[model samples]
Target chain A: MDLAEVKRIGALARLDLGEEETAAMSDQLTRILDYVAQLEALDTTGVEPTTHPVTLGEAFRDDAVRPSLPTEAALANAPATDGASFIVPRIL
Target chain B: MAADSDLARLTLHEARDRVTAGEVTSAELTEACVARIEEVEGSVHAFAHRTTDEALAQAAARDAARPDPLPPLWGLPIAVKDNICTQGLPTTCGSKLLANFRPVYDSFVARRLEEAGAVILGKANMDEFAMGSSCENSALGPTHNPHDLERVPGGSSGGSAAAVAADECLAALGSDTGGSIRQPACFCGVVGLKPTYGRVSRNGLVAFASSLDQIGPLTKDARDAALLLGVIAGHDPDDSTSACQPVPNYEAALEAEVAGLTIGIPKEYFGGGLDPAVEEAVRAAIATYESLGATTVEVSLPHTEQAVATYYLVATAEASSNLGRFDGIRYGVRQEGKDLLDVYKRTREEGFGAEVKRRIMLGTFALSAGYYDAYYGKAMAVRTLIRNDFDAAFGQCDLLLTPTAPTPPFRLGEKLDDPLTMYLSDIFTIAVSLAGLPAVSFPTGTTAAGLPLGAQLIGRHFDEARLLAMVHAFEATGQGRPLPAL
Candidate 1:
């Protein structure tokens, strides 16, 4: 991975990394990517992917109403809140 | 005061008996720990937040009740990792982003401990979002290893393990995603158990890698691990991933016969880069098992080298997704911007530390449009082979034994700059997490320099009972490291 690629990835992740950080990430990510490239040597043909270690197929629960977090409590931590709703910057 | 100090040093199971017999008031024990924390926390930096006042109050209440048959965790003062939420206390995940965030509700694991009458001493420090092998990544500050203050208490569960080692808390709750709990326990010379992936609920363990993460116990001894695991391990409707299977009486299984057990020694684990002292201690541990009539066989994990590479991709991808919940508007410290996108970018940029940022970008790259198939998808497929290796090995042996870490506790800041080197520290412990098997790290012996060297015993899924029993049996042999003089 190059510095430009690292910067692009940072942008995709919604992170505004500094120039030095991008450079470091570029060097580190390149090493990590190169290391992981060893996996390509092995043919994983017909092998099923293991996403969840223990795949508990769809945990079901009763469709009954339970107490939910109060709006005030949820909004309490908001950086900008007007009692009920969180205030976010204007979006298009 | 001497009574308090003595009580502080007692292991969880030992203290439980004393408390049950009315030999020591919970107040005395709690005060002892509080005093100990006050004394050594200056050097160890084990806790992110201390709840001495709350813990004392809780202890007083437990003494007042003095039930006929005490609750399992009655009078036990324990620490919860900062990542696990506790309603009235802050849960930081050792990050600046959630540094001031007070959880409105308790995590499933925290609730279980409280329900069992355990007094939570505080939240332990960790690597930011449980991202690093050493606690140096914590925004709160690094946790110094109690044994050698200049060295790291292995992490991202470093504080939890350190607290238990220093007797600040009888035990602690730590989450393991690629050896976080066990490696630190090994470094701190304590017993740490990482239960099967779904064995314990992950309701509020701030997700780093959801697929690999499991909550476990870090305690002074194997029996304590069993006691703590029993309290926290069970199905919860709150966590869909929680196993519905019964939580076995881990304590009862302590007398499990190791005589007929077959322990596998992975040849790959005894390879290059493994410290000679670590290998000797681990080999001696195997001999000790042999003396108990347990036979050892060599097993191979052909995919061992690729495990770390595969883990970074899989874990980073999951982390990037999970961390999306930390956008500026909802909670935590946020940097304001002209618009929503700008706010997110600025908030995350300022909030996250170096290691966390590196991982987010790495993960984003893996899951990005053009790279997903090559990186993330390939990693998932390789993860299968890694898991399959364990399943095949378990076919021949009841458990697998390996050195918990390649080396003893390294000096603080030694591997800080090199992320790949830090990642390799968990080599002995990571594959077990990938396989979602139950494993425990217990002190085998110490290096000549007196640092802890641990042996890991990996077992089949939901086989924590047998794993703990074997660990208890090994600990019973009394060939272990002495406590660090904090």
Candidate 2:
């Protein structure tokens, strides 16, 4: 909820909130975090957690080849694109 | 029938009959639907975009080019949840990140519907990235329940439910990840089906939690629901997660009697927090089903308490990863700055809403190297236990019945400021997501305040036929009859 915590969370989320936005979001997020934190107070100590509401398996499908959109169609809306894929600024 | 309300009252089958009989042309039906949208949509906020021209054009073509008798659902106007990609139409998932991004190809379900001659009415609003149970997180605005303008239509698929409830469209497609489809259907007083995961391909759905997401129908009646499901459900070679199970004729199961079926009533669902009115309605629904010849039995799903925590961890983690593609370099929103990192930072900072950022952060924290085992890994283990609980329960009973939500729809902004309360709106629904089983919600009745109440019926994995049969029987008994308030 503090600036430091906000910065840490932003980093973890792969986001970069500016100083002003960070401070604002920190306050807003603090309220939510505080509310969600109440879940910890519940006595789920002996309770086993539930991951799904219904029972099922890994739900895997067989790998098969299907038609892919041609490069022109696939990159139709790309702001910038190379011959076969998207082009972007150098990360380094 | 008043054009303003005629389209709203007609079921998909009825609409199809009229179109085929020349009582109403597809263009007339489409115009009526568009006019209905124009009238009530200001209050309901169900549609994110209204394709009046496109819908009418499609309907006109359906009427003009009918070289043979119309197919089932031919010329019917149906809405699509914004999360499903429609070629040339913006598929925003109610997020700023993809607000302007349009796909070049439609999702399998979207393509299938078009092939079946259903006119694309428009796209309905939803939670940002389909992350929240309440539609409150939508970048546009909260979708109001049609019965009452003040209350929320249960979400991540609130728009679809509201659109159907308000008669904006004959039926709409909704995606269910932790009860996104069923919960809102309950809140809005309509029928929402979450077909067994994989029964419907997830190929073009914008992923929230990939493993749990399934596209289903939100319709005015069970038979319409079956028709919609029949068109949407099937194996798709394009999706690696698509199920190979045969898609049964759901309509054939519609009139099937549930005389000898076993319905399980879990004690946990009727516990302390359930609203008195909701409890009464769901119990009455169960009693009605019993009178129809189905036997009721008490069953236990012991690992119920930890569902919320486990769901958050797993869903957030998967969402965190699935959403990673939204950097400025991708297909949607882009915020310019001096350099690459700045672009990433600026785009995300401006694109994601407060709730989305919160989940991404929590998911990142859970998936972090040091905490993965304590959080995400542990959550997975707990998910297995929950699945096992359902498996054991299914052995004792054919299907499980419970209230769709603890309470009926609350006012739109009531829980907006309280995140936990909003999250808890999905408590009854998340367990079904975790177990990856099929469930549906149908109207039970109304609360004293006049909002709709709904009940949840869950079936064994890949047993959507049985689930639909049960819903069909319930619908026949009129237990889920829509109230007169709306």
Candidate 3:
């Protein structure tokens, strides 16, 4: 929960942080983790992790091609989109 | 015998009956809600987006086609939480990131409501990305409690609850990940039901924690809650997690008696951190239930202390994964940067608020290499134990009764600076969400300050019918549905 740790986690989460934010996050994350550290007191041995409360068997859809959103609708919310394609910063 | 002009005061069930009997037109009902919203929107700040024209048009259409058998929600003007997608309307989710983003299609819940002939009043404000306990986390602005203007309406569904309490709409939809709907309903003096997970489809809800988030109703009373739940609950092919079980007639289930029911009071919920007034009010509610011939017993949930920690881990981990879609590529606001990586980092950094960033960072750290087992994995295991605790308690009783929140609504910005203190606001309501059980928060009494106090009734999974029945029976005692003096 140090400044370096905060910065590393922020970067890993795809967020850019200022120096002050990083420092504040370090303290806050440390406190939260310290609180969370209480979980270590419990013995969770031989317990199965519950990912989702409702247990559903495998579901398969009919794999039918249905009507989808038109291209205009699909690109309606895009920040930067050509008529038929999205525009982004160059990769290489 | 409320007049057409006083349609806002009618419960969803009453309004539906009147509309079916031709006593009032949907246009008049929509006008009443619109006028109410116009009168109070300045103080309450409940709605993020108001759709007056669309609502009126929908109402006019409903009036034109007076079908033989009316739809369940016919002519009711209901507000939707901003996180649930609505076609052709801005679904901001109370964040700058999606400030003007309108979806191309309606969410499953919205579509069902529309098919049932409900008038879409507007989108209600909420915590940014449904993340905080108080509505103060909303980037647009915080919503004020209808009971007291200075105090906050609890969140992240604060606006929905406030609107229902203030009579801006007949009822509203709210998504609960961790007490978002129930706590706000408790604060605003309304009935909020969080149906069992997978009981309602989540096809288009903006995911915070997918497993824990279920859309439910915030209404003036328990019967209204049942009516709205019936309209929205059921399986959806679009949502794979939706249960394929037959949907029950929840409104009909409300007529059943609760004479022989056994309600458990979890001892842990009454301990430290509980305000005396809130505890006393909830205890009085339990006594009323006892007088109605329902038995009460003390139960234990030993892992209660670990729920907040486990919820944070599991919810944040899922949020981090789900929110990665908002990288400025497909939709939402984008900030141009030097490179693609820079675009993502800059967009997210500028778009998300502090609380969201803190959660994303925490999730990233927990799920990162070498730390997953110690943090996220352990949290999942502890979650099992927490669910087991509820199962064991329910085995002893039919329902668990407790205070919805540990305290009454505080002043705005009271706990905004301290994140841990804010997280503790969901202390009593989080375990039920983790267990994916059905629960409702109904008003028990008002505090000396006149703010509402609520008691929660938790039932076994998929047993919402019984829970609604118990709440309806309690409502018949004249203690439920206290309207704020707005």
Q: How many residue pairs clash in each candidate?
A: 0, 9, 0
Pairs in clash, predicted candidate 2: A51-B383, A51-B434, A52-B434, A52-B435, A53-B431, A53-B432, A53-B434, A53-B435, A54-B435
Per-residue CA lDDT of model 3 for B1-486, tens digit only, reads 455448898899988998998888899999999999998999999998899999999999999987778889887899999999999988989988988799899999999998899999999999999999988888899999999999999999999999999999999999999999999999999999999999999999999999899999999988898899999999899999998878899989998878898999999999988999999998888888899999999999989989999999999999999899989988899999999999999999999999999899888888999999999999999999999999899889999999999999999989999999899899999989999999999998899989999999999889998988888888888886667788
Candidate 3 global TM-score: 0.99
The DockQ value obtained for model 2 is: 0.35
User: Native-contact recovery for every candidate?
Assistant: 0.90, 0.39, 0.87
Expressed as tens digits, the lDDT of each residue in B76-102 for candidate 1 is 899999999899798989989987899
lDDT by residue (tens digit), candidate 2, A2-85: 889779868767697777867777776566444434344334344565444433346565577778788788777665678578
* lDDT, candidate 2, B132-187, per-residue tens: 87788899888888888888898999999999998888899999988999999999
Could you give candidate 3's per-residue lDDT for residues A1-92 as a string of tens digits? Answer: 99988988888999999999998999999999999999999999999999999777776799999999899889988998888998899897
Per-residue lDDT of B118 in model 2:
93
Tell me which of candidates 2 and 3 scores higher on DockQ.
3
Q: Model 2, stretches more than 4 Å misplaced? A: A1-6, A18-67, A81-87, B1-4, B67-69, B483-486
The candidate 1 chain B region of ten consecutive residues with least summed lDDT is B1-10
Name the better of 1 and 2 by lDDT.
1
Each candidate's chain A: what TM-score? 0.92, 0.73, 0.92
DockQ of each: 0.88, 0.35, 0.87
> What TM-score fits each model?
0.99, 0.92, 0.99
